[model samples]
Target: MQVAYDYEYQLAVADYWQGRPTMEPNVWVPSLPLQMTVAVPASNTDLVVSSGGQQELKLAVMEESTEYQHERSNPMEDFEKAARAFEDDLQKMQTKMHLFPPSMKGEELSKYSEPKVVSIGPYHHGKGEAIPQMESTKYAAACHFINESGRSVEEVYGAVFAVADEARRCYDADKLRLLSDNDFKPMMFYDGCFLLQYMLFMCRDNNDEDHPIADLPWVVVDKLMKLMPKPGLDMETFVGRVKQCLQTRRHLKFDPPILDESYKPPHLLGLLRFYIVGSTDSSTTDDGSGQGLSDNAKKVSLSVSVIELAEMGIRLTADKTTAEINKMRVTRGWFTGKLFLPPVSLDDANARFLVNMAAFELCITPDFGEVDDTMSTVCAYLCLLGMVTDNDTDVQELRKKHILQGGGLTNEDALELFTGLEKHLRPGNCYYNTIVAIENYRSDRRLWIKLYRFGYRNQTAIIAVLTTIAGIAGFLGTLKSFQ
Candidate 1:
C-alpha cells in the first residue's frame, strides 16, 4: 500500500535527463494500486473524471470514444408512442362496446388443413399455463420487433406449455367447460395451439377440485390422415434444442425441424396476413418499403365443412371491390372487368374491429370455451360488444379461432395480476363477470353427482316416507292440543 518517495523522484530525474515528452496528467496514474490517506487529484488539470471510487484525474488528452457521445433516433421509442396512441384511441372508442357473447355460432366450420390433421400423441406431456410475464423493456422490444418485422405465413410457432398450462384458463365455469371438452378442437382454427389444453386446466376451478380434469380422452388433429410426414425430432430432440439456448449466451445452432409444406394449415396464411403482417408500425410508415397497409385491410378466410366439403366458407365477401379482384383474373384464363369489393366495409375503425374480431374468432374457435370465470367474462364481452357473430358455424368458427386461446395472458396470470391488469380507469373490467360465472358453476348439477351417487333410490324413498310420517304426527298433536 505504501509507495516510496524515491520512485517519484527517480521518474522526475529520468524525464529531465532524457528530455522526454511530459506524460498526460489525465492518464491513469502508475500509482493506482496504492492506498491514499490525503486525497490528491489524479489530474493536475481542473477537468477530470471520477475513477472507480477515487478522485477524478485530469488529462489533457483523452482516449477514443470516452467523452463525446452521439444521439440516435430510437425506433422503439417511436413504436411505443404509436402503440400508446392506438391503445388510447381504442379505449375511447371501444370501452362501451360489448366484445364477447355468451353463446356464439356453433356450426362446424371447415379448415384448409383438414386432410393433414394429426392427433397429438397420448404421451403428450401437456404444458403449464403460458402467462406472459414480460417486463417493460421486453414488452417494448417485442412490440417493436413485431411492428417492424414481416409476417411469416406458413411457419408453425413454437410455445412450450408450462406444467400449469396457463394460456387458456378462464374464470368462468361455462367457458372452462367449453374449453376443456375434447370435441371442441373443430371449433378452433388449428387443432388448438400448444397450451390450448393446458389453459383449460388453468381456468378450471382448481380450488373446488384438482381441476386438471383428471381423466382425459385424447382427441388430436389427425396429422397422419393429412399426408404430412412427421418431423424427425421428437420430444427428446426438441428438449435438446431448448438445452442449447440455456447452455450458451448466443442463439442456438439448431433450428426447428422443417415439416413438409403439403401439411401446412391454410389458416397459417390468414394468421400471417393479420397477426404478423397487419399491425406492424413500420408497414404503415411512409418509408416506401411497401411495409405499411391502409388503415382498412382485408384478409382472405377459407372454410370447408368437415360434414360437407363443397359448402366452402371464405372470410371475404363479394362486393364492388370483388369486381376489381375479378378484373385481374386473366391469369386464371377468366376475363373479369368488374372490381372485387368486400362485403364488410373496412373503411371505418369499428368495421375493422369487427372484422379483426371475426378473424380472431375463426382462429380461436372451439379451441376455448366453457372457460374459467375470468376468461368467460372476456369472451362474453367480445360477444356483448358485438365483436363476435351470433350462433352459427361461420360465427362459431371465428370465436374458436380468435379469442379463447388468447395467447399472451393465461387464466392464472389474469388472476394473479387481476388487480393490476387493467391499465385504465374505465368501468366494466371483464374480471367482474368472471367471478359471477364461477359462483354459478359451483351450483351446477354435475358438481356433486359423484359424491351423492351412493344408494340414491333407497335413500330418497326412505327420506320421503319419514317426512310423511312426521307431517301426520304433527297434525294429530295439533288437534289434541286444541281440544
Candidate 2:
C-alpha cells in the first residue's frame, strides 16, 4: 500500500511538469517511507476488498483438546525404597573382596598385576607363555623334592588332588571358573612342590649342591661351566635367565622352613608373602593386633617431599643389604629422624609379582580401609613406598640417599612403577605408625629450624634497637632536668 502511494505521487508530478522531478536547489522531491508487510485472510464468510490497507494480520488456527492422566507417580517414594535395597545388598556383598583388587583390574596395570615369568597361584594358573616353560621346570622341582621324602611324583599328585576342593575355596571364585578340579590338582601339586623345594634349597647351607634345583637345566649349565675344562656353555644367555629368575622369585630368604602345616597359605604367592612377612621383626611390623598405639595417626599422612624432609634433619637410607621386602625400620630422636626403606629393584618381572601379591592381599582381607591385623605386611610396605616416593624427583632423591635400588630402571620408569600403587590401598590399623611418627618429628624439627634461623639473623638488630631506646630515654631525662 505504501509503495502504491509513492508511485501515485511520482505519476502526478510527471504529468504536471511533463518530465521527472528535478533535483535543483530549494526544490523538494516527494517520497514515502518503505514498509514491507504480508497480508492475512479474514475468517468472515463475506469477502470485503479494500483499495488501501492499514496493517497486515497473520491467520492461525488453534485447536482445543482434552488431556487425560493414566496414573499418579511418587518418584521420591520409589527412590527411597531402591536406596534401602541397595544398602542391604552392599552390606551382604562386602564380605568378599576379590583376590584381584578392582583398582588393579584395568589393562594399564595388568602387566604389573599378572604373572609373567611364572604363575604360581590358581588365579594365574594356566594362561600364558610362562606356564608352558615353567610347567616342566615345576615338575622337575616337584620330583626332586618328593623323592627326598621317599614319595614318588604319583603320591604327591594324589595328596594335593585330595585337598583340591579346599585349595579352590582359598582362591576367589571368578578366576578358577575356567579351571576344573582335574586342572586345579596338577597345578597345585606342581606349584606346591616347586615352592617347597625352593624354600628347602634356600634354607640349606649355601654350598649345598644336593638341592634339586641345582639339577635344573640353567643350574646344570652353571655347574657344568664351573667343572668343564673348556667353555662348556654360552655364559651370557643362561646366566642372565638364571639371574632374572632369582630376582623375580617372590621370596629370597628362608629362616625357619615355611612348611608349617598348621597355617595353610591361599596360594604360592601367598606363601611367599607369608614367609617374607614372617621374616620381619615382630616389633617393626604393625599387624594392627591391639586397639592401636596411643600416638597412632588418626588420618592418612604421607611424609613431606624428600628435599623438605632432609632440610628438617630427617635422613633417608636404603636397606640394600636386606633381602626381605617387608623389613622397614624407622627411628626418631629429638633433633633427627631416620627412615630405612627396604631395597626395591623395579623391573617388569618383580613389579608384576609385587602387584599380584598386593592384589592377593587385598582380596583375602575381609574388610578393606580398616585396621585389620591379618593383612599382608608386604602390601603395607609397598603402600608406604608409594606414599613416600611420588614422582621422578622423589625417586632420584631416594636413589641419591641410597633409599632405593633402581634395578636397572631410570628415575622416570621408577616413578611410573610407583604411580597409582596406593589407589584403594587402605592402611591396616597398625600400618605406617612409624612413618606417622617420622612425619610429626619432621614437622617439629622444621618449626625449630625456622625459629632458630630467624633469631640468628635478627639478634644484632635487636641489640641495636635496645641501645637506641636507652639513648632516647637519657636525652628526655636531661631535657626535663634543664626545665
Task: Please give the CA lDDT of all the candidate structures.
Answer: 0.26, 0.51
Give the TM-score (vs. native) of candidate 1.
Answer: 0.17
Q: Which stretches of candidate 2 lie over 4 Å from their true place?
A: 1-98, 106-108, 139-149, 152-154, 197-264, 278-303, 319-330, 345-349, 368-376, 430-432, 442-446, 451-483
Question: Per-residue lDDT of 20-136 in model 2, one digit per residue for the tens?
Answer: 344333222222233434487657343444458544454454544444244557999999999998676445332222456676765446656555555665656556775556666
Write model 1 residue lDDT over 1-483, tens digit each, in one string: 353321221111122224434433322122122233447757546654565666664556554573445656799999999999867644432111122232322221111111111222111112223212211222233222222222111111111111113222212234345343222221121223322322222333321111111111111112211212233114223322322221112232444333333432222212112221111122101122122222332321121122211111112113321211111110100211111111221112222233233333333333333332221222223232222232244333422433222233333332222122122111121322222222222223222433333334356777888999999999999999999
What lDDT does model 2 reach? 0.51
| Candidate topping lDDT | 2
* Top candidate, metric TM-score: 2
TM-score (C-alpha) between model 2 and the true structure? 0.54
TM per candidate comes to: 0.17, 0.54
| Candidate 2, RMSD to the unseen true structure | 31.4
Clashing pairs in 2: 318-402, 318-403, 371-429
